[model samples]
Target: MLNTPVTIIQPSDGWRSLDLRELWDRRELLYFFAWRDLKVRYKQTLFGVLWAVAGPLASMVVFTFVFDKMAGLPSDGLPGPIFYLSGLVIWRYFANALSAASNSLVGNQTILTKVYFPRLIIPLSSCITGFADFFVALGVMLVLMAYYGILPGIAMLLLPFLLLLTMASALGAGLFFASLNVKYRDVGYILPFLLQLWMFCTIIVPYSEVAQRGGAWRFVYGLNPMGGVVEAFRWCLLRGAMTGPGNANATWILLGTGVPVALFILAAGLLYFKRLEKMFADIV
Candidate 1:
């Protein structure tokens, strides 16, 4: 009998660079993953895709009444509905995407155990699933804009950049939490409360109020990744007509402070996720 040669394979160290080429090579798999998530989201729902915009629409109404009417919070110069909806559109997407990504690993545990693929694809697909909702909810913003007589301006070109920032922020935080969640299921419980607090600190309130606090508070406000994203979205879609807190300089300041923090988070998340990724299969 002839002896057959054996080939040995080993898992790479956790600290290595991500294989982007491999991810690209498996692009079709990513598409299927994203499609699976999207279908699962609206599957068996009464309203189907309409459910996507419902939450943000309802939140806009409640916020307009409570913040704009009851508390008398200013919306810069823009109308309350437009201002709130503008921020809500972006906020809702980030919140939903972040939650989806955070839970992705545990949610897809069966696939993780059965197959070999880039673990990042799971969370990345979760992020993609939110785009459907994002675009759907965006229509609500347009309707509000028409009602309020707001039009897209030159700044509208910046929307793609703002969107990219939102994606990065969501994925960064999501990866960090998703990795932790595999070991500590408590992350799922804590996420809702954290998101609520995060929203209040984000675009739920007018930026003017945060700016008024001055000193370190202003700097701190800029540190919140979504703060800049919300403001930038408002600025772009509102035609730069927002006054006071919406001034060009202030928007730049928030972006200046917030962008770096977002990028830093992305870097940190990638490092951490890669470090622990090898263990996920065994652990999960």
Candidate 2:
């Protein structure tokens, strides 16, 4: 009888490293996790996917009324709905992704205890699940833009990059919190308040307001990361419709400042998450 070779699997040594190739090889599992999250998200819900469209639309209406009509918050000279909805969609995605990803470890404790796949896949799938709602909300945004005859310019081409920035920021924050949540659990409680404060810090108010500071304050505001994302989206999609003073320099400054901050967060999060990945099954 011929003897066949045997294979043995061993844990990696030293600091945890992200094996991109292994993740790629397990892409099918990632798809399964992402798809499962999508189904589970809307499962048994009356509105199903319409909840996605409704969330931002309803927020847009409330903001338009409160900010535009009641408080008379400037929409950068653009119609209230479009201005508010554009920011809402991007903000909604980030908030949702962060919330879900942060909770993913505890939420899927059963799987973690029983499975051997990469732990990173869990939070990653949560991020992708959130994108499903984002795209749906994006469609609603497009319709509103058409209703107001707002046309996207060549800058609109930057949307994909801008979106990547949003996702990176969310994932960075999400990973950090998700790991912390495993041991502390307090992170889950604080996330809502944090996100609320974060929203106000972003361009839910007009970017023009931030630009008015016109110095270090504006630069500091740029460090918020989502500020850059909101401005980029508005610059790309609402350029022609915008009615306020434009600052090409401020836009560049925000993007420049934001990109580095986001990158730093991502790098830190990845390292922290990797450091904690081995303990997830035991802790969770």
Candidate 3:
């Protein structure tokens, strides 16, 4: 009789020992997970994908009425609708991505116990699923821009970089919170309130407002990561129309501060997630 070979698997040790090759090998599973999330999100919903456009659209209307009409807030010299929608679209994507990714491990607890795959895939897929909503909302923004006769300028070329920054920020924060959620469970409850506060702190109103305050205020706001992304989105998409407090100098300040902070969060989150990876199946 021929001898049979047995394969053994063991947990990795040390910070630098993470096997990213495994994640690359499991790319197919990642796609399936992302597709499953996209379908489950719209399943049985009456409006289907329209639900993606609705949230940002509704917020734009309220912001237009309350901030532009009532509070008399500035629109950065762009049309009120497009101005608010610009910020709303980016902010909504990050907020939704962060929320979904943070709960991914706990939400899919059964699968974690039954199988072995890159645990990072759960939160990463949730973030990727948010791109569906982002593109839908972006389409609505383009329509509004056309209606307003606002043309995108050469600055629009920076969109891909800005978008990468946004996704990185969401993934970083989500991984951190998702890991915590497995043990504390209260992370799920506190996340909504925290996101609400984060939105207000960011340039949901206008970068001009934050920039005008200047000094430590702008520096602190840039540390939020999303603040820079929102500003860059406006700089890219609304460059031809924006006339308020925005300027090239402000954009530089925002990017310089936000990019570094976002990179830090992403690195830290990955390290923390790897450290906790071995215990997720048991705790989750």
Model 3: residue 186 alpha-carbon error in angstroms: 0.7
Positional deviation of 207 in candidate 3, in angstroms?
2.5
Global lDDT of each model?
0.87, 0.86, 0.86
The alpha-carbon lDDT assigned to residue 110 of candidate 1 equals: 98
TM-score for candidate 2 = 0.93
Q: Write the per-residue lDDT of candidate 3 for residues 148-259, one digit (tens) a residue.
A: 9989998888987887888898999999999999999999889999998998777456767866786888777878898888888888898888795677778878889999
lDDT of 1 at 187: 97
> What are the C-alpha RMSDs, in order, of all predicted structures?
3.1, 2.4, 2.4
* Candidate 1 lDDT over residue span 104-211, tens digit each: 999999999999888999999999888999999988888878777778888888988888899999999999999999999999999999999898778777676778
Q: How displaced is residue 247 in candidate 2, in Å?
A: 4.0
For model 1, the run of ten residues with the poorest summed lDDT: 1-10
List candidate 3 segments past 4 Å from native: 1-16
Candidate 2: regions farther than 4 A off: 1-14
The true-versus-predicted C-alpha distance at residue 107 of model 1, in Å, is 0.4
Q: Ranking under lDDT, best-scoring first?
A: 1, 3, 2
Off by over 4 Å in 1: 1-8, 11-14
